[model samples]
Target: MSASPRARRMTGAQAGAVTARILSAAVGGYALAYAATAFLSVYLPMERPDRVSFASLASFFVWVATILYVFAARSAWRATWVPLALSLLLGLAAFLPGGYGVRP
Candidate 1:
């Protein structure tokens, strides 16, 4: 069955929201993966190989969760911003001076 006319025609605002949601999911997934891996690498009291293995496994779930959360949020705007804010915060926490891998 074909889609209804209403379903086929998307407004500019609706299109923009869809695009935002997609971009948010992609970027949020990447950011979440990176941040989670970095965090596990630094904080997990395990050997380097073990830490890397654990981080890699955890990052997959992080990416999946980010995508689900972004799509499930009531407001697309919030869906975009919340993950971005979390990405920024976690990224900064993982990489800042005196953080995980700093050599100072």
Candidate 2:
């Protein structure tokens, strides 16, 4: 069966939005996961090995959640910026001088 032209077609802006969403889901998700893992590993009160292992495991969930958020967002720009902002915040917290594991 043939679908209507309008139903079957994507405009250029729609394509671009989809592409942006996919890129954000893949790249932004990974970056967010990395930042979350780092932050968790540094801040979790558990022993070093336990914290590392738990953080690594939790990162998988974080990545999956980020991907979902990117797709569910109202716009591609929102998808991109929210994850980027979160990644930066987490990365900063993980690496900042006053954060745990930082030396004097």
Candidate number of the best lDDT: 2
Whole-model lDDT per candidate: 0.83, 0.93
lDDT of 1 by residue, 1-104 (tens): 99876776879998998898999999877887888888777667888889889998999999999999988988889989888788787777767846455622
Distance from true location, Cα of 20 in model 1, Å: 0.3
- Candidate number achieving the greatest TM-score relative to the actual structure: 2
Per-residue CA lDDT of model 2 for 22-87, tens digit only, reads: 999999999999999999988898999999999999999999999999999999999999999999
> What is the TM-score (0 to 1) of candidate 1?
0.81
Q: Could you tell me which residue pairs clash in candidate 2?
A: none
Residue 4 lDDT, candidate 2, scale 0-100:
72
RMSD of 2: 2.6
- Give the lowest summed-lDDT range of ten residues in model 1: 95-104
Q: Per-residue lDDT for 58 in model 1?
A: 93
